[model samples]
Target: MLMSGSVSLYTDKASLYDVDYLSKDYAVEATFLQQLICNAIQYSPAEKPHLLDVACGTGNHLQFLQEMFVCTGIDLNSSMLAIAKQKIPQAIFQQADMTNFDLAEKFDVIICLFSSLYYLLDTALITRTLQMFVRHLTSNGMIIIEPWLTPDKYEEGKCAVQANQTANVSLTRLSVSRRQRDVALIDMYYTVYDGKNVTSFQDTHAFLLLPHTVLQGIFDSLGYATEVIMKAPFQERGLIVAKAK
Candidate 1:
């Protein structure tokens, strides 16, 4: 199963985490998130959208969202929020948990990107978060979600992948032991060899891997019109878009 710890990755040993290396991953994730947002806006009934980016680490997507909509981000990490505030000065960033967060206003489009929804580690928690998303959505709003690979598609195991540089750092990372059937867990051991020094750090994340049908059923029960698209363009990830019924 995917094991996770509460230890902050951005502690004093931040060099071990390699912000430059992770920034590349964040870029790709932002591209996908933008695409999803664009599609949702095109299909949505709203002219100008209001977006909520749940677990918006460092506000990368939130910055992009601000270009087209009034965007707000919510994340559990204050340091990340501080960085995000620097990046998107006009947008708002709040510290909140996705599974049980409450906001007074609803949004026209709500996005939980980069598999952050999986961090909840429980199917019930995932469901609760979805319900909350629905509750916080305008009547015609859409909820766009991207989840990690299910056990049926990619089994739990170890794999090493190299990242293309988008910043000063280039690195290779190993993903070890992602074996939660109901929830996908991955431990990324990233090794960064800066010109002067070498450092390594691990980021363990857990994601709920509910089947597409299960998610559809949940949305249907909640009076939503849902669509599940596998292998979306611009990336090899799956997407679920749900609109109010």
Candidate 2:
């Protein structure tokens, strides 16, 4: 059971991040993104396309994406970036914020996955982040995002729990969903057993319930072509794929 305490997942708990999400099928998600890129940039007889992952925590996707593209990842958390850099030394890793980052170079594809966009907390920031991504994209570049649950699909007051363990570490996550207007507040409690000791902490994650219609409008207003694919990695979470008009 989790007790009353708070810890930074981006800092002291960063090493356990991978253990918490050990079951996530990064390979399948990478394959899906690869297919999308292939279809979008068909027959490009140039060097390998450049790919930028914004708010790319720990570079899980980059591990596989690097095989097809020149991968670059940026995250605001230095700890996460450190882990990512150690994992994929061949790829570029930087500490950056998604809303206002300038890489001074263009990418053939820019991705923000794992619903990281929701951390922006509002429609305006979402738009600002998209614009920033657009600025760093090549002429025909595309942006792919795995969005958080939309307003219509969000189930308020829901409880969810997950447990995972390895040879030396055990992790259990219990989360409850609540809402404050457009933001979905997930109160998460985590308890870990590392064979020798036990520890527990709590964290609250607020994600803006970005509606698909609003997302489409934002893309339309920005003069971009967009599509919302409902059948994405997390099923109901959906995906937003966009390209400059």
Candidate 3:
């Protein structure tokens, strides 16, 4: 059986999460976001902006978000946060749920990347999470959400393989995901070989396959200045950019 919806694949794989995701071209992503911010606000923040990355995972994006904004990361997994802390000790990290969290400070930019929002799994949870993002943003802040695949875009029983090797450690991941009704049911198998030892584990993840119109409706109902950019990373799943009304 799949575990609770709150389960994170990174709970045990935090060490390698950085090695995998951090290697992506984050500078390009950063540049894109910067342009979005400029186009949205028509000016750069006068001072270093405070950025909050919801469901930040292993803080791969933080390395670039921190370049233009002071960065803070929040994730559901403590192990992930621990690894993120070590990787970017200068930034702040917290273990917090995206659907509900309280931060004393508001952020100039809030982001949830890599289809993490779909983990909310239902309209109620997703709405509450959108409220959380709005509540945490400054007066002029923008929220950038990278959505997951819609039902039509999702491939059933899709499989992918990834492997990385270093002098002391070798790691491999095999993932397969299929739609279970309105959710994407994913099974990920990971194996790590550290020369002297070997370990393996599996994690199951669930993502809500929300329709595009429904997501846009949420933004419209919230009365935000909303725009969906078609040219985004990751198979052009699209990006949702919103600002408070």
TM-score per candidate, in order?
A: 0.80, 0.95, 0.90
Candidate-wise lDDT, in order:
0.71, 0.88, 0.81
The model with the greatest TM-score is: 2
lDDT string, candidate 2, 63-137, tens digits: 999998999999999999999999999999999989999999999999999889889887888899988988898
- What lDDT tens digits, residue by residue, belong to model 3 across residues 27-115? 78777887787677533557788889998887778877777778999999999888778878999999999988998889888989888
lDDT of 1 by residue, 36-117 (tens): 6676555434555788999887776676567677888998877777778888999878998888888888898898866677
**Order of quality (TM-score):** 2, 3, 1
In model 3, which regions exceed 4 Å deviation? 1-8, 42-46, 232-235
Residue range with the least summed lDDT across 10 consecutive positions in model 2: 1-10
Cα deviation in Å at residue 232, candidate 2?
4.5
Can you list the residue pairs that collide in candidate 2?
A: none
Clashing pairs in 1: 118-207
lDDT of 1 at 58: 75
Give me the runs in candidate 2 sitting further than 4 Å from their true place: 1-4, 43-46, 232-234
Q: Better model by TM-score, 1 or 2?
A: 2
lDDT of candidate 3?
A: 0.81
